[model samples]
Target: MNKLTAVAVSVLLLSAAPAQAQSIPGWKAYRAQQTGQQAAPAANAGQAPAAPPQATDPQPAALPQPAYQTAAAPYATRPAPKPAPNGGLFVGVQGGSGWVYEDVDQRAVAVSAGYRWQAGDYSQVGIELGAGRLDETTWRDYGIPEVKFNTIGANARFNFGNSPWFGVARLGYWHARSRDGWDRKVTADGAYGSLGVGVDLGRHFNLQLMYTGYTYAVDSYYGDDEYDINRADTVTLGAEVRF
Candidate 1:
């Protein structure tokens, strides 16, 4: 019986020994596992660590803008105006007081025709031919012998200035005939000068006032005796029409 007890005790101890040993940690195996864990980091040390992802704000999209360009305009030109005709011909008439050879009692009238050209911007040069008659008293106190003396003349006129109004000057020659130079007379000539102002009533009409003087000569038939008639003065009001 003692022998049986000793054998049972040995068998129980043997079974418990394995269980206790396995429950407790082993130093060699634990150290070897720790070394393997430590060595894993060292093995990967040659490779770089990846950087952490960065947070970013979203950007707004850009809008399209309008573009501008400059271009120059084309140059333009205009035409000039034509000038008015300057070669128009005209005709006229004049009347009022006139005297012969210092005689204040002579009364006269005239008709004229003319041609002119524009000489410059505001001036004209022209020729005028005229014919007329004057009533003259040779011897008033001696029962008054009266005669209408026939006269003819020509003039060169200058018109100057540039408005509705203008100034005029004239130089001329005149011839006179006495119905009776004491009884029948011969033909003779006279000299004259004139000055005046005029207004243009419209594109084709004119009005004027003038002062003029003349030196007249005449002859009688018997010896065809010649004599001079002096200081013939005149004041004239005139009008003209143009084409």
Candidate 2:
């Protein structure tokens, strides 16, 4: 009986040794790790899930475009008097009617050419040469059949503020020749002066109203008496072009 009791006690001690190992610090954790490895799926197990395909370094995004552009737009209409050329060569013409020393109504036409330099922000100074013809005139009741005048002069022009309107003045030496109905010709030389106002068009053309006066002293003797034709006054509409 003693031997049998000793055998039974040894078998109960071996069984209790395993139960006490489960109460040890890491025995239950070790068993659960072994069971989870055996229960995992065959295809994805222990391969770290292929590292989630490594994310391929993610493609960069494209930059966005600007909202506004810098190109200029087309105009609906063109502007006038667009800041005329500062200095250049010019040509001009004039036509009108006038009186010769208050005695004759004469028709007249003239032309001029000059070179101008800019004198200020809105002004110019220049010299011009001009020639004109007069018709249907009576000189001191002499019934002159023809007359002609020529001049060499300097001129100044001014624009009013910012407008297209402008004023001009000129003065110079003048020479005149007249022929009577009897074909008797007399020549005189003196000074001429002119004043004018005008509008500038498209920076290159001008239209104006002008008044000019020519005063001449003649050194001619008619029947042993000396005669002088004082002056001729003319009003003209004029046009000019500049380059």
Candidate 3:
């Protein structure tokens, strides 16, 4: 019976030795890991909660800009327009009636030549020379002779805006030579004036109606006045050509 008891005690000692060795190192590591995990939770609880991610508004995309171009300037300057020709030589002819005293009238004819140049956009200035003849007339009981006249003058013309019509004026010196009845010669000298209106017929031709006036003096055989002075006036229709 003593041998049996000893054998049982040895078996129990052997089993308890393995259990004690494992607990010495492995059990301590496991206990420390559990203590660290529990302390981390307690430390975080003392601080404020972390802020959630802030919501940011989305920005719009930028648009592309357009490029602009400037206009180019002209390289050359333009020239001015030229003016029309406003100077020329001219010739004219006229025929109409003449008057001397009361109820005394006769046929008359004339020719003229001149040169004109521009004075303004609406006017021209010139000089003219002319000659004319008046047919014979009977004065009361005395038979008067034919008359002839020569003239030199200054002349002016005016245009009515842009129309084809114009006005003319002339003032001049005149001389008259003729023969009276009974083979007697007569002579006179005086000033003459003329005015007319005209229209252009083409580039170089024109037509006009004109009136001219002058006075002549003749010695009288029976009269209170020193000389017999008579007015000689004519109305003529004329045409002219210009160069």
Distance (Å) between predicted and true CA of 16, model 2?
Answer: 56
Task: Please provide TM-scores, in order, for all candidate models, with all chains considered together.
Answer: 0.54, 0.60, 0.61
Cα lDDT tens digits, model 3, 110-147, are 99999998998778899999999999877777776788
lDDT of 1 at 26: 97
lDDT (Cα) of model 3: 0.85
lDDT of 2 by residue, 7-97 (tens): 9999999999999999987999999998888777765666765555555786789666543333334443455544554568889999998
Query: For model 1, how does the per-residue alpha-carbon lDDT over 1-243 read when each residue is reduced to its tens digit?
Result: 699999999999999997877666795577679999999899889978877888888798876553422333345444444334444687878888776544445566777777777776666777777776666554455322233333334333344434567776777787766544455554556677788888888879899888887776644344566564555677889998877
- TM-score order, best first, reads 3, 2, 1
Better of 2 and 3 by lDDT: 3
Q: Which candidate gets the maximum TM-score versus the true structure?
A: 3
Q: Candidate 1: which pairs clash?
A: none
Ranking by lDDT: 3, 2, 1
Off by over 4 Å in 2: 1-85, 101-103, 137-142, 220-229
* Candidate 3 colliding pairs: none
Candidate 1: minimum summed lDDT over ten consecutive residues — where? 142-151
lDDT of each: 0.67, 0.82, 0.85
